[model samples]
Target: MSEKKFTKIDCKELKLGMRFSAPVFFDDGENMFLGEEKAVKNYHINAIQRWKIDYLLTYGHLVTDGKTAAPDSIYMLEDLEEVEEA
Candidate 1:
């Protein structure tokens, strides 16, 4: 299997109702944090802050209404492969 790529997102920067297109992973990138289609809620943010987590990683991009969400407060680091293609 090909190695999976990941994007690291800051917990404090996640906007209300933001959703991921794929399952979110923990720092290790193997453990699942939240499933796809699950919108970012108050509780999720609370837990991350309460636990003092710095960020989360995922193989998916942010989505809303089946489209890629535009960057707002979050400055998503570009995937190296994507940058190379551009």
Candidate 2:
């Protein structure tokens, strides 16, 4: 497994088909996600549903999957940063 840290919201490092696990705060409280995008809008809804995610504050790109579909966005948390350590 590889990880990359991002100091910016929705760091461009996120890509399609790549899995993300972020712990966030929601109106109901807090939750986490370990999912990948299946389409353009899936990530938006997925993030909002899992936590109080606002796409405007986040920005992520598609991960290159040489053989399958790509994802949309990658939500960012306060103290979290992606690390690329394989």
Top candidate (TM-score):
1
- Give the alpha carbon lDDT tens digit for every residue of 1-86 in model 2: 87433223342333434432233222223222333333324564565546654332212334345555432333333114454332
The C-alpha local distance difference test score for the whole of candidate 1 amounts to: 0.76
Q: What are the runs in model 2 whose C-alpha is more than 4 Å off?
A: 1-4, 7-31, 35-52, 55-62, 70-86
Winning candidate number (lDDT)? 1
Q: State the displacement of the C-alpha of residue 5, model 1, in Å, after optimal TM-score superposition.
A: 0.2
What are the per-residue Cα lDDT tens digits for candidate 1 across 2-81? 98799999887886678888998877788887888566766677888887888899988987585454443342355455
Candidate 1 Cα deviation (angstroms), residue 18 = 0.7
**What is the overall TM-score of model 2 with all chains considered together?**
0.24
